[model samples]
Target: MNDYIIRATAGNGAIRAFAATTKNTVEKARSLHNTSPVATAALGRLLTAAAMMGIMLKGEKDLLTLQIRGDGPLQGMVVSADSNAKVKGYVFNPYVEVPDKYEGKLDVSAAIGHGNLSVIKDIGLKEPYSGQIELISGEIAEDLTYYFAKSEQTPSAIGLGVLIDTDITVMAAGGFIIQLMPDASDEIAEKLEEKINRTPYVTSLLDMGYTPEDILKLILGDFDIEINEKKEVEFYCNCTRERVEKALISLGKEELEKIIEEDKKAQLHCHFCNKEYNFTENDLKEILKNAL
Candidate 1:
């Protein structure tokens, strides 16, 4: 199935949720970055979550960025997404070898160690809104749950998972976010807790060929599942040669002259997509005119 996200409300809007299946998107990321199995899992989970969170914006040009600065072998992970559910990200150390935390599961927490989660939203405001919290667990879900509750003051349940295949490809990857409204009744909240605890892991649901809608129905079935919107999500990076050239122009006349004088050429690597942009001497000189 194509990767997509479902936005919905349940129990008369007292509960809002989002769910998505991101196997293909995660697999794409693994291939582009050539991440190790453990790094793939860690990056996949974060990317999946970021895809859903990106669409939470109400503006056209809004952007959301999630950064994980860890203290383990993995070092860090950075994901940036737009309101269109187009997400791109990378790991600080994508090939760090680490033992699995469980018999058949990747040890994301140990690979990521403990650090901070930073959520930054640029919504055409005076300043981009920013929030940070200590990682409750290096696993993306729990850390996000803690982020929502403490940073946003909204009690939430977040579950994210990435299953790796024997060949080191992504087997499954998906997640769900359920949040309680301010006036959610105690009874309904209790029921939500019960249902969530009984439900299977997000990746398990995806492995069974469950769609985002099906996953939400499994959790929000007891409540009225009012799906709001559905949108395709993908591993997309919007970096272009023109944009990279503009950046080089922004470096000013002296910087461009030095590059033209010393290196005569430059290669720019985009972290989001691992694509390299080459600038020859003539290209740099052309950019230099604009810089001057």
Candidate 2:
């Protein structure tokens, strides 16, 4: 199924929910970075969550970034998303690997070890809003849940998963986020907590051909559901040769001259998409003129 995200409200708008199916998106990341199974699982989960969270911002130009820095083999991961649901990211160690914790599951926690999760939001503010929290489980989901409750002061339940095939490709990837608004009654919150705790793994449901709407329906079945919006999500990077040229100019004339004198050429790589841009002697001279 094509990747998409659905936003909905339940319990008479007292409960807000978001769910997404991101198999294609995750597969694209694996292909771009050539990530190992454990790295794929860790990065895929964060990318899925970032895609959903991207649309949470109120402005079109807003941006959200989710970054995890850990002590394990995976090292760290970063995901950036815009309000349009355009998301991209990279793992610090895409080739990192670890034995599966069990027959069917990748060892994401061990691959991430103990670490910190950082959330940064830029809404054209003088200073972007930032929140940092200790990683709870390095499993992505539990860490995000803790982030919401402690950092954002919102009670939330987040479940994220990525199923990697034996061939090291993504088989299924998806997640769900449910939050309690202030008007939520005690009974309503309690009921939702109970239901979410009992639901099957989100990726397992995706493997069964469940859409984001269906996943939300299963979780909010008893409560009245108001489907708010639907949007497509994908692995996207907005890097270009023009952007790279401007960056080289930003380094100032002295720096550009040193590059021309020492290296003779520059090869710049975009971490998000792993795209490389090469600038030769002539290209560096052209950029130097523009810098002046």
Candidate 3:
């Protein structure tokens, strides 16, 4: 099934929920970075959560970035998403691996030890809004839940998971975020917590061919849910040859001349997409002219 995200209001507008399936999107990132099993799981979860957060924006150009700095082998991770649901990300160490935590599941928590979770939201404003919280579990879901409760003062439950195939490709990936809105009653919050604790693994449900809507039904069965909007999500990078050229030009004419004199060509690689750009001596000379 094509990747998509759903936004809905449950419990008569007393709760806001979001669910997303990101199999294809995460697979794209795995292919681009050639990440190992552990890195694939870590990066995949962050990308899925970032896509859902992207949908929370109000304007077209709004963007969100999720950064995790941990002490484990994976070290750190960064994911970026825009209002259009276009997302991309990379890990500091894509080859880090660890033994399974339980039942042979990926040891994502071990790969990402205690650290910090930082979120930056740019909503076409003078200054982007930013927040930081100590990592709750080094697991993306728990960290996100902590952020919402501490930073936004919204009680929330977040579940994110990614299943990797034998070949290290993403098999199934998805997540759900449920928030208690204003006017939520204590009884409602308690019941909602019970439901969340009992719900099946989000990734397993997606692997069984459940759509985003079906996942929501499993979580908020008795409550009235209004589907607000839906949008396609993907792993898309906004890098191009033109942008690389502009970057080289900004290095100044003297620097370009130095590169031309020493090496016949220059090599540039994007950390996010892992695509390499080659610039011949002629290209360097042209960029030098643009610098002046």
Compared with the true structure, all predictions reach lDDT values of 0.92, 0.93, 0.91
lDDT of each residue in 180-283, candidate 3, tens digit only: 99799988899999999898887778678778899898899878878898999999999999999998888877888999999979999988899999999998
What is the TM-score of each predicted model, taking all chains together? Answer: 0.97, 0.98, 0.96
Better of 1 and 3 by lDDT: 1
Root-mean-square deviation of Cα positions for candidate 1 versus the true structure, in angstroms: 1.0
Which candidate number has the best lDDT?
2
lDDT for 53 in candidate 1 is 93
By TM-score: ranked, best first: 2, 1, 3
Error of 2 at 8 (Å): 0.2
229-282 in candidate 2: lDDT tens per residue? 999999999999999999999999999999999999999999999999999999
Per-residue lDDT tens digits of candidate 1, residues 1-292? 7899999999998999999889899999999999999999999999999999999899989999999999999999999999999999999998988887778878999999989999999999999999999998888899999999998899899989888999999988888999999989999999999998899877678678777888899999989899999999999999999999989988888888998999999999999999999999999998888666
Error of 1 at 198 (Å): 1.8
* Candidate 2 residue spans exceeding 4 A from truth: none
